[model samples]
Target: MGNAQDKPPGTGGGGGRSDQATAGSGARGRAGGSAEKAQTHKASEKRVANGRENSPAGGQGQQGSPAVDTSYLDAPSGALPPHLARLKNEGNHLFKHGQFGDALEKYTHAIDGCAEAGIDSPEDLCILYSNRAACYLKDGNSTDCIQDCTKALELQPYSLKALLRRAIAYESLERYRKAYVDYKTVLQIDTGVQAAHDSVHRITKMLIEQDGPGWRENLPDIPAVPLSVQQHHREKPISVEVAQARAARAAQEEVRKKEACFTLLKREGNDLVKKGHFQEALQKYNECLSLKSDECALYTNRAICFLKLNHFEEAKQDCDSALQLEPSNKKAFYRRALAYKGLQDYLSASSDLQEVLQLDPNVREAEQELEVVTGLLRQSLMDSSAHTPRV
Candidate 1:
């Protein structure tokens, strides 16, 4: 697929939400603070095994184009002190070799080198801070990463690196307003910073035109999010804390509709099962499981797939898991009995059906099955009695 940046124009409608998502491994509950998930056509383990470089969002990094706003924060065409020059060369070398770890160390030394040498001008400090911020980002220390970028902004207000990195950080935090402000700042720095320009334009369109809850109290009337970023955000799970926070925000705004992405995913899995794509259906069901383990339907559906695949042991295990997560799931009990039956473990199956009837006395299938088993057990007892004759 083309890079997100290379995509043809899309109507920048709505605040960024997307339908497409990657599902992987067993789905976890949507506890909601910045939890990211993906779609799964392939098993997560298989997908990871076929992988390359790591990114924060758990995908391949996009190649970054040259910053158009580079001119916005260059040191004023003057000679740099010798130590600063040497530090710059060393840092650049490490960064170029993809040695982000060592490069990070070098940048830290460079920052210390500047302080010891009294090279603390705002413009110079801003550049140092920005370079170091990149190192922190490469390390996945986004909290510190954004702080450094903010420091760069304090020094060089128009610094594109600072603006963009701050936006990146805010997005990582799911703080759309602050991110939008930083993006907007890029435009004021220069209109030619087309990536930021394009990003700002796109984000604005998404917030205002593309998705709901697009407005922010912090910035000028910019749309505030990229279409692709919004699309990525859609269906993405957050830690419980973050989801609650976002829920609070939307509730106050009275904007977003009822949340059902997990339910939606589970429903899709059900549809897949109906088409007899057992493995594929399990993937979808497992994806839902990852989002909300408490979701009774996810476990039941996945167990159904296991049963269809004739993996009775696995089906029973899935039922056990589902019932633990949702004790009231009658379907789990019904299926657990069937799994036992498939394994010819009639006693266990009878116990399960007994539980099913307890949960739903009107279930005719459970009643009929229970009666049949009971009759067989009685006949066996009578036959054994006859065989023990005179003993």
Candidate 2:
């Protein structure tokens, strides 16, 4: 089998029997480790008993010691053992080479071995299931993908990869409501994750497309979010007026640092835009927005990237955000009008172009766009009239 470097994304193995237990021991099956140690202790005690019987003391302490149970000693520790590790490595190799069926077979063999050995570490099981889910997804078997990811999440509820994969599977099945819910879960787990945020935004639109305006109401009630993940973001409770003043000062300083960071990100995005790397530029803009969510210029910059990428809906959305921040922004109006034109919403395009003209009559680009949009609107009206029944 190949090394970890050879494994692809979503299929890489982490902890094994050889690896030390992580800080979150429960997740890593510490109980199973303790069971293994207890078995070893029993074996050592048996050796001592034999030694005592052979010695001149003649097992003096044997009568006083209570009998130890060895009933639970049959199973090995729950971590991935060497035999199963070989199977996983083979599977990862096959998966990397596009042999999903062969990879899945190896993974299945490993799973069967775990059951036989009573190795039921949730973390290990979750990794195997997620890797199998990745195979299912690659094979375009959305049903199997969903099943595998569901199994993975059952073992480890906060498995972000499993949730994301399941969301994608739901989307493939056209179960937009379920997809939206899963993506929302990912966002709640980590709000700073740009991909999760984008997935949530995209799936919400998909839900609306399938279920209309009140699509959110059709979704299942979201479970109460676990507070464990949010602990990092909570500030220390403050009561003293002087301490409050110091905290306010620190908050102001943080805001200044964030602004400085945003400026650097915006410059990077602009550079990427100039180099015709619209996708990379969009990523920069997304990171910038995460830092300063309400910055109108960030939205405007991102809208330009979306426009260049031909993602008119996303472009329109960014433009809307920009306009909400500053309605008088000419760039926002102009970019939105371009997106509307791209979407063939000629009336909206024309209206936005008129706004651009009102904002600056001498803007030749706006004037030209208005002419083109007006012609399209007139043509659309004529076509509609021709299709209508005579009154």
Output the number of the lDDT-best candidate.
2
Clash count (model 2, backbone only): 0
Where model 1 places Cα greater than 4 Å from the true spot, the runs are 1-157, 160-268, 277-296, 383-390
Identify the candidate with maximal TM-score: 2
User: TM per model?
Assistant: 0.37, 0.41
Q: For every candidate structure, what is the RMSD over all alpha carbons to the true structure, in angstroms?
A: 20.9, 24.2
Q: Give the per-residue lDDT digits (tens) of candidate 1, residues 1-391.
A: 0011221222121221122132100111111122232122123323323432133222445568332221211223224464454444445555655655544544554455455456657876677667766655555555655777877878766566677776766655555566677777666554444566666666676566534563654445644444444444444564465567667776855533323666677778888888998999988877777667676667778889999999999999889988998887889999998888788777788888999999889999999988876766577667879899694
Model 2 — TM-score against the truth? 0.41
Q: Residue 174 lDDT in model 1? A: 56
